[model samples]
Target: MDKRESKIPLIRFPEFKEGWEHKQLNELLKVSKKKNKDLKYSKEEVLSVSGELGIVNQIEHLGRSYAGASVHNYGLVENGDIVYTKSPLKENPYGIIKLNKGVPGIVSTLYAVYKVKDNNADGEFIEHYFSLDANTNRYLRPLVRKGAKNDMKINNEYVLHDRIFVPKKEEQKRIAHFFNVIDTKINQLKEKQNLLEEYKKGVMQKIFTQKIRFKKEDGSDFENWDNTTLGKVFKIFNGYAFSSKDSCENGVKWVKIADVGIQRMQRENVSFLPFEFRELHKKFLLKKGDFVIALTRPILNGELKIAEIDDFFHNSLLNQRVGKIISSNNLIFIYYFLQQQWLINSIEKNIAGTDPPNLSAKEIDHIKVSIPKVKEQEKIAKILSNIDNKIAKSINQIDNLKNYKKALLQQMFCY
Candidate 1:
């Protein structure tokens, strides 16, 4: 190895002095061999394996059935051991868990149990470290060779042999502790964001219900808002179906209704359709402020989202399942208003069919909304937008903390 000054900051602890030592993950850890039997239990312990954390009692998963249910034949797990969900939803590739509850439980064969060898590495540090890196899944992913595209099944054998890196013992604890603090801050921010969302919801309900009123330039009330159908205020432009084969490696961005995530549109990692496909789906060209709502899904079945295309989103095409709303009303105000619990409930009530419920343009237009003057709508939109900005900032802070924790993990272990 070429001798060079390390660019990374080194920690000086009371008990440790060396910069750090590197080692293979197999050197400091061993995988569990206790096989889980298929025997069923009448009064099972209700154990579940957390993706980053080890096995915990039934309460952790809220008593959800895991891997088709089996008895407690598997070896018991302790705190700080790493256990993963063998089958995870595709969108959520990493699954979940970075900490474990020290509780009595057994895991299914679907879970791979990794425990740090005695004092060779800090279990807490390793747990936090492995939790952060998606790279670990690089090896673990291929093991999941079967199941649905959304939920693929993985085996323990694959995870147990997966190679990982580790750092010196002292560095492990420091890094884990450092990341844990950052994680706490992230969780706190998330809680604050949730509160802000709740506050906005409450305000929306009050403002729309006439509990709070808006005044005009003449200082007169806008009057009890008129009850209007959706079609009256806006025209719904349904997107055209573009063939999947027409999608290109790099071309004009296409917004499938699925591109609208649970909260906002995912501008990055967007799929692209070629110019020829765009010609075929010319009517689906999306404007900057267009509200694209998913009309079909069990995934986002009850979800309504507004897409805010940035400068980069020019020439993007919207998919047929997405309905673009061009409103005479303030679009942001309408978007948040639809996000209100009451509106979602109302829309959900009118929903028909069981096998993947779909909403039609007529059904969308029939959804009733209390309409205020355009000016008043703009005012309401401004207030809600401020709250959303705060929420967005908090969300960003959470993301930063998660990134910090992940970085700390990579540095903590010696492999």
Candidate 2:
């Protein structure tokens, strides 16, 4: 531990000027070894501790019961109780601690349950101390021990005796509350994003089914839609067969079928071709407003990921198993139409039942559709696009807030 950490954290409240005192975990918190008393009948929420989500009710989260035959022998935990799952995780080798709140519940027997012994020793403060980058990547990592089954576990004695520097009770509460406020804001934004997405989905269904028809400019009914083959409106094109040797770090972007999904194009997993060979990939390069889909996955419920490429994804070369649809019709309208269940089912029926189902470019070209007139298509696009914009903005805001909190966790704690 750095000498400076013993005296103060990288950031702190202005009023707390004294150095924090170090104490062993056992001295600060008491182990809760009491077993569940409801042996006759278990009725409370069945809890489990996940290193990622912390402690949560298993049945509610999984949409079904994952609770063993019964949790009669499980450990009991109450509000403000701190629980630790002592199993190793790939990212967090020393296990993880979660402070349970809101209700009293029962966790599996295979966890360490404890209570704050010192009235001044806040559970939230301890949770933050353990979670901070300065402690996770630096202090706790080194203390993990190799145990039976080759799993990493911190020695019970070592963990119990491990010392941590803590601020006064009031200061600790303030710091914990600061993070809580941020968490509440993030959750609110997430709920807003979810509602917007659901609203857009419902609207799409209504418009496609003609339940909500678009009117002509003069407030008159538009002409009936005409049935037409997709080939007339779209020029279907399959991606190039790029070899492994063509991969490069700093080169032209090569978008594979897997790189594109319903959530939009994934930027991090994209591969590239040598910049010098950009000329060779010119014919395969994608442009803004191109409709693309993963042909290899065929079409399965929720497996169909199709989207219209925006300027952000322009100039990208399409790789094998991906197909792009170029058309004069509004690309945005075609993008959403492809996502409708009927179109997805039509595309799936063409697959030949190969190990991994695949779609042929010809099949995509020949599929028939009843399209709206150009004006109606544009109107539908605007409604859907507006909701998309709202969802996108909320998602971006949530991501930014998470990053901001992560930065604070790293900088505010002692090293």
Candidate 3:
């Protein structure tokens, strides 16, 4: 192994005998707050932002729901610029900025951009260091204020005044290179995962719509698919309204729609309800294999369609606006089927809502579904389940790697 030393030996290379130089951010950088810039852009050139991945240029506002506004004010950003939102106080408030292809607009007023000092460091290298998980959380977390109306509000002064370790230029580049290699692998896997999901969604659409049919081993089509209402095939029930007044540390497990994470049901995030209330709402208790669907959401255009009730979440009861699928026609099959895009489109077409879109039991009952033989359904589920199993395993590995990298950074870098 190549030996390295510094205040922390692991942070610097062995060949590098120079001690780290501490410096104020402004002294080593040209800091430009987007809000303070005097730049302007036409509506056509206006850029949209989300967190730190600067200036989306597709002009395709294809989101799960509504798209956000465009930034048209004074904000200078180019390739390699580090951009971060400065208004909303958030748990982790910063990200390394990037200007995507086809993007031609200036930075949004929400960002604070930093151009590295030519005498001191490489801009890309600094951006990479700042993008490190530990640095982002360590530097930005404390800048957040609790009572701020916006979730994040970081000013230029706070960031500029914070003291940071400035390694020699060569070391900075080397460290950035190491992390960038790992990051590329992680990003590549993530893209594969996304593509696999899209493929599965497409397959689901074909199967449910009868565009593609599952054939029996005998080379014959499983009898003409029957049409059935979801209500008949599954038991749909509303969740219990656990009283906020009696909420305490030790109580029965309760879940809200918000408790459901993007891809999995967050059993660990569950809150406890009073025992009396739990007993009263016992009928609505969750069981493994049960599906929980978010019934109330303004963006009900089919996002967050389903969640399986895992064993860890057993005895948990759903809360108001969340729909529990107590029983179903082979849940494993239903789970994969609901994840299909075509099914989501169908649900969206039939969904009824006011200000906050809500899917009712009646509307759910009217949802048309292809009824395949239970055995065939199980078979199809198995095929898709294997693919998903691989995807989940890959994600777990990535999480472990990220955690390991975080731990390594903490040990190697000075906090």
Q: Write the per-residue lDDT of candidate 1 for residues 1-415, one digit (tens) a residue.
A: 1223333333334565554443445556677665435443322555675543345565555554443444546654556666666556343364543335565456665555667676778776666655644654654554456555655465444444444554566666776677668766877888899999889778888987878888888998776688988668777677777668887898878888677665578765778887676676667777676677777751354555555665566668987777776777888777777776666766666665545667666655787777888889888888888998999899898788777666655544332
Q: Model 1 residue 272 lDDT?
A: 85
| Candidate 3 residue-wise lDDT, 1-415, digit = tens | 1123335435555776777666556666667654423435544444455443434642444333221364434566655555565544243444333323344455455566666677777665565555565576666655555344544555655666555676777877777677668777877878777887777767666777778777788887787866776666676688876677767788777778776654477655567877777678778788776778877761344465477777777777778878776544677787776665555666666674465667777766777676787878887888778778877877887787677766656654554
- Looking at model 2, residue 283 earns an lDDT score of 84
> Comparing 1 and 2 by lDDT, which wins?
2
Give RMSD (Å) of candidate 3 vs. truth. 5.3
Question: Listing every candidate in turn, what is its Cα RMSD in Å to the true structure after a full C-alpha superposition?
Answer: 5.4, 3.3, 5.3
Candidate 1 lowest-lDDT run of ten: 1-10
Q: Note the Cα lDDT for every prediction shown.
A: 0.64, 0.75, 0.63
Candidate 2 C-alpha lDDT tens digits along 1-415 = 2233455778777888877777666766888876777563264476766654667777666666556776778888888888877666766666677888656788776577888865768888878777653465455566666677756565444556566677788888899999889888998999999999889879989998888998878999877776897777666678889987978788888878767777487676777788765687688888887778877884545447787677767888888888887777887887777778777777777665676887776766678878888788898888888889999999999999989988887766654
409 Cα displacement, candidate 3 (Å): 2.9
**Runs with alpha carbons beyond 4 Å of true place in candidate 2:** 1-5, 40-44, 50-53, 86-94, 131-134, 137-139, 146-150, 154-158, 228-236, 298-303, 310-312, 341-353, 361-369
Off by over 4 Å in 1: 1-78, 88-106, 112-118, 138-168, 217-220, 275-283, 298-301, 354-356, 404-415
TM-score of each: 0.76, 0.86, 0.79
- Which stretch of 10 consecutive residues in model 2 shows the poorest summed lDDT? 1-10
Native-referenced Cα lDDT, model 1:
0.64
Poorest stretch of ten by lDDT in candidate 3: 58-67
**How much is 9 displaced in model 2, in angstroms?**
2.3
- Model 1 lDDT, residue 303, Cα: 54
